[model samples]
Target: MRRRTLIRGAAAVVLVPAGLAAATSAAASPRQKSAQADDLVGVDVSNYQVGFDYARAANEGLDFVVAKAGGCQLSEGPYTSDSYAGHVDGARAAGLRVGHYFLTGDFLSPREAADYFVDNLHDYRSGDVLALDVEVLDDSTRLWNDAEVSTWFNRVRERVGAYVPWFYISTSALRSADWSRTIASGARLWAASWGANDGSYPGPPDLGGSYPDWAAHQYSSMGSVAGTSPIDLDLARPWAFDVSGPTDPPGGLPKTSAEQDGVPGPTMWKRTQNWLRIQSGYTGPIDGVPGPNTYAALQRNMAGNWGYTGPIDGNPGPMTWSAVQRLAAQHGYTGPIDGVMGPNSWRGFSRFINADAWD
Candidate 1:
């Protein structure tokens, strides 16, 4: 971090109209001015392990980057990290415009989705764009139908407000839904048509080339830029902005514990507990406790990705414990789920909710 240099208000007033004063101000870094550049070319790096190496890309004529922020209905574990914080800082250092993408989740209510987005967006500021990756599930996953999905997208736009350039990724799932008109009406489109990259994606062969309305085409899935891995699209179109204001909605979450003193809350916790119990066929008080029955429900849920290796019994050995821990951590729960609680776990949960809980 560098020391702050103050520019007097008199000088700021005189330099407002000509633009040279602000351009020449010691306070404004080269990166801040770079936001005014034309034709923004960048990529959407959403994978966690394969991080953003902006300096290398900038050397390769990269002008901007849309980093991945969250995914799948408020599922946690950021694709970006503190290293990425400095990575974007380096991009700014290299005079590149930067933006972000939020992978939309299916099971989340609109409000929950908004909360997830706001939590991750605290780092972004003026002139940045906000994008929504609208392709998560395939033909399975009954979380949301096409129409319901569109509604969720609109809810996101409403919550995010108009300061940022709100955009959408049109994946195969989006194409199948035939909700193009519905979605495009509100958001700038980032169409995904894999011709030379991820084999033949469905629909028109030249969707990207022909779709004049799209802000950018996710031209490839296995993109191999210099310092990055073979990841998804790593490019975007420039000139997508008309204003240079805050890219996120104003007024973030209350910072202190006392700020969330009293309020009626959603039944998501109860709903989640019940859903898990029935899936495991366990009889319990739907208490928010992560008891054996709750763990049973989680095991069944984790059969695919979260790492549940054994039967749906109440015991959480190494495998089951690992899976439970992974799922909990992904959803922004940093506390240990070793069927135990302590001060650290309580602090983690408190931070996770960022709001007061009713006793």
Candidate 2:
């Protein structure tokens, strides 16, 4: 998440993660909650979190990083997030997935904000997901009703191709603004709601409010990680849809997941084929459902020390799981060989599948 094209004369308010204006406010939040480190860890930082250390934060179990990319400053007009460049380079170096966001200023039209957003993230690859911060940063700035938000988002989509944008808004703002239209308009959303570490927040934003469920929830803006403090804590549900475009750290992992495809049909196989291409130079169709050609390609990859004794059938079973487990073990997994594929297992296997989404 680096800089984007600036929109002049427009006023925009950029809230630090968790609505805190600064890191000192991390303490102002409710007491830190205790949760499993294995949970998906993330943080959103702006210039307010000065001298941000991307490596240390990743070591702190950070799985992803969201950096402020666009915002407007009075006379300054629109500018990229001052910290965008450093955060983007550092986060990639630390082996973390990256996401970008734009703070919609008050004075600009929806299309202007959308175009600027697209330009700023123009360098982002298909692997990256763009987001729009839909809250009113300044009390004086007019609130963006659901229709306006949707307009900005759709325009962004028009510029960025198939890459879907995630809406980042506080739960309270969502309620106060009556944002049902905005929520229902988009296919995915990331709800911002803060509370103790007991992990009491519901799985998605208000389930009954607008969208059926949230793709991610910001549990705490002031939450602490093992290696980083004053960072936002979030839980992202595995996405069920497929996303593709240029990727951050080119040739890295794509953001799609098996859960995102639901029940692992042809779409799941398509991702596997793409991963195989990366690993062994596969040249098969990326169609979600693969036929004999896919299994044939897979057999070629299983040769030598890759380990697979089963027939060259595309159908994956115990033998296939055993081979997959063996590969996972090579990729730093020490779990029991019970043939059970856990998150850690997936992490190991995904590397062979798609390097961009190793996490």
- As a TM-score, model 2 comes out at 0.55
Q: What digit string (tens of lDDT, one per residue) describes model 1 on residues 1-359?
A: 00011221112111122332332222211121111133345555543324466677677676666665654432332233323455456567777777666655454654465556666663576677766666543222443454554454555556655534444544554435544333332344566665444312222223221112344555544444544534344333343543322211123223324113322123323433443332223345644455677666556545433545587676666677565455446435566567453344333333423321111
- Every candidate's lDDT: 0.45, 0.56
- The TM-score obtained by model 1 is 0.46
Q: What is candidate 2's lDDT per residue for 181-223, written digit by digit as tens?
A: 4533443567786645333343334422333235556776555
Off by over 4 Å in 2: 1-39, 73-76, 176-187, 196-204, 226-228, 240-359
The whole-model C-alpha lDDT of candidate 2 against the native structure comes to 0.56
Report each candidate's C-alpha RMSD, comma-separated, in the order given.
Answer: 21.6, 13.5
Which stretches in model 1 have alpha-carbon errors above 4 Å?
A: 1-39, 47-51, 73-87, 137-160, 180-185, 198-212, 243-359
Give candidate 1's error at residue 116 in angstroms: 1.7
Report, for all candidates in order, the number of backbone clashes. Answer: 8, 15
